[model samples]
Target: MAPSKTFFSNFRLSNIVNLLLRSLQLVDGLVVIGLYGIDLNRARKEDKYSDGKWVYAVTVGSIAAATAVVYAFVSVFMHYRSLTFLFAWDWVLMVLWAALSGIFGTMYLNEKVEMEAGIHRMKVAVGFDLAGLVLWFVTAVMGSLWFFRERWGGRISRPGKA
Candidate 1:
């Protein structure tokens, strides 16, 4: 039998989606980092009871961002076959990250609205959080498509047993 000329075999959609996922992951990570930094600064300056929430956001965001950056770098720079074992887990993580980011963004936006004044920095942080949520969702979707494409023998068929 000869080699198939499917999308995955020729590095077409899979490669494109992989690159897009990596780029979005990088952007999401950076945005989360920025949000964490801003939240940290705000916590330090305000010292409000609710600052603990920001601290929690920062802690979670930092870890999530770091994970995203490392994953993005590996997915982009390393050989494709070398990371095949991670495809399933990567998509799962992206979904989880998307959901968590959406929750965090909503929380921050709510907090921003509750504040009376001097919320410029918090607003910026909330904006970044929102951006991160969008990026995470897109990345998750792309990753899922790539996963299904590979699993379905690269024909873009309905997701099920081949």
Candidate 2:
């Protein structure tokens, strides 16, 4: 159904969970950006220098935040659900988060960190990225169910739901 149709219809438990998860995704992304961004800004102040690692992390965090906002808005205002699109994006996010986690983890283990606070921030960043990975995985599974719903005698796709 179109988002407009769902808006006035019953508000199900799934809707609440959807909103909660999306909100968490958005916040988690912002937190990672903020954590890495502090170091990035400090580096700029010290000598107009920024580490590539922090830059890459911040970029990924920005992408995560933007996806959460855009997808949530579109799902609410345009379609009640876009299963295929959501599924694709969830997987994309999952990979990005995994990469972020792996990169930060490697960097930390390599003993290249310079400051205690920086170490703390990196650990937190990895935590958030892993959380994002799990969240995306969960959403991807939910999206998969939508595809199966059509095949298993659940609600078949309407004309434009594809």
Residues 1-162 of candidate 1: C-alpha lDDT, one tens digit per residue:
344544235454455566666566566556656656665676668984545556655655665566566665665555444455555555555455556556555654656455555365556665666565565556556556555556775565556746
Q: How accurate is candidate 2 locally (lDDT)?
A: 0.77
Which candidate comes out best when scored by TM-score?
2
Estimate, for each residue in 49-110, the C-alpha lDDT of model 2 and write its tens digit: 78788898899889988988876765554443544446777888889888888988776755
Backbone clash pairs for candidate 2 read none
Residue pairs in clash, model 1? none
TM-scores, all models, native as reference = 0.57, 0.77
List the candidate 2 regions with Cα displacement exceeding 4 Å: 1-6, 109-115, 151-162
Candidate 1 residue 91 Cα shift, in angstroms, is 6.1
lDDT of 1: 0.58
